[model samples]
Target: MKVILTETIESLGIIGSEVKVADGYARNYLLPQKKAVLASQANRNMLKQEKARFELQIAKEKAFAQEMAARLEGTSCTIAAKVSDETRLYGSVTERDILNALAEKGIEIEKHMLLLSEPIKNTGTYNIPVRVYADVEPEIIVEVVAE
Candidate 1:
């Protein structure tokens, strides 16, 4: 029997995919578990459309991320926070602090995509990697000056 999967099935297919499986398995497991449904003509067509839409959205986001990374390169941003006598931050600079500093410079970035080996602990210059695409990574300079 052919079924349209709503979620990934390890041995079968991914979400919105159509695959053939044993009728007993479909009836007793896949369908009952709501992992899939009978692949009607309408559903097949809808799934194809959905796949195209998802690809298009991903492409758009990749392009935007690339542009933002280009703008981020060769740019330095600063974050002012409380510091101790030894120039160590009372609390280390976090991804949130980095994002906020980027926002101040009109560069918006999500914390998940902001790659840092560790939080900024002492006053110095540091570099952070920003993933623009699978192959395109950009660096941003962070100057942690005493405040």
Candidate 2:
């Protein structure tokens, strides 16, 4: 089904773009979440009028994400955990552990924004990327140390 997107969906299209998606996906998720609307002449015209507003909002959001990226560029977190004889962590350091460490440093971010592909299971320094925006990703140094 063709739908007009109201937000930027990575898998889909950007704001105000018309695209065809599965019927069930459009009905169950997009419409219910207010992320898209039915593609119609009226909706098209309305979206055309609101396109400027959406662009401005997107610009502001990008700017904020850029600013946050700058702040996070020099930021690093140290996580202490119990280790075995081989210097391997008894328990892996997950995203929550990193989030808590950042919170302690007065930096707050959504869980989904932190792009941790897997848990840290060793004692070493690693760089993790934080997805601040569609095009803005900043890396933070994470040092996992033995306790």
Candidate 3:
């Protein structure tokens, strides 16, 4: 069945896109979930008009993401933890710690956006990759110091 997607669906289509789906799936899932509307002439005309606004909104979002990425690139976050005499952290720095540190620096980020291979076990400086946008990945330096 032909439908106009109201929002982006994984493995399907983006917002304001016209797509064809199985009749059963469209009727049972998309329609019931209000994720799409029937691709009638009237609905298609409305979607066409809304497409321009949607494109503009997406562009603005991308611009904001880029700006955030730039700011993050220039920023450094520091975290303090109690460590043993060997300079090894008693407890490693996890995603939550990174998120909290960033928040304290007036930068808000989600846990999933940080690409951390492993927690920090020793004290030093580390560069972490953060995905501020889907395409924009900026590296931020994190300094781990013993308390």
Kindly state the number of residue pairs that clash in model 1. 0
RMSD of 2: 1.8
- Sort every candidate by TM-score, greatest first: 2, 3, 1
**Candidates 2 and 3, the one with greater TM-score:** 2
Tens digits of per-residue lDDT, candidate 3, 96-141, equal 9999998988899888889999999999999999977667899999
> Which candidate gets the maximum TM-score versus the true structure?
2
- Candidates in order, TM-scores: namely 0.59, 0.88, 0.69
Q: What's the residue-level lDDT of 145 in candidate 3? A: 97
Report how far off residue 48 is in candidate 3 (Å). Answer: 5.0
Specify the poorest-scoring 10-residue window by lDDT in model 2.
8-17
C-alpha displacement of 89 in model 3, angstroms?
1.4
Tell me the deviation in Å of residue 65 in model 2: 0.8
TM-score, structure 2 vs. true:
0.88
The lDDT of each candidate is 0.81, 0.92, 0.87
Give every collision pair in model 3.
Answer: none
- Best model number under lDDT: 2
Q: What digit string (tens of lDDT, one per residue) describes model 1 on residues 1-147?
A: 999887655467556678999999999999999989899988878778788765665567668768877888878998777889668888899898889988988887777777887888988888888866555679999888878
**How close to the true structure is residue 84 of candidate 3, measured as C-alpha lDDT?**
92
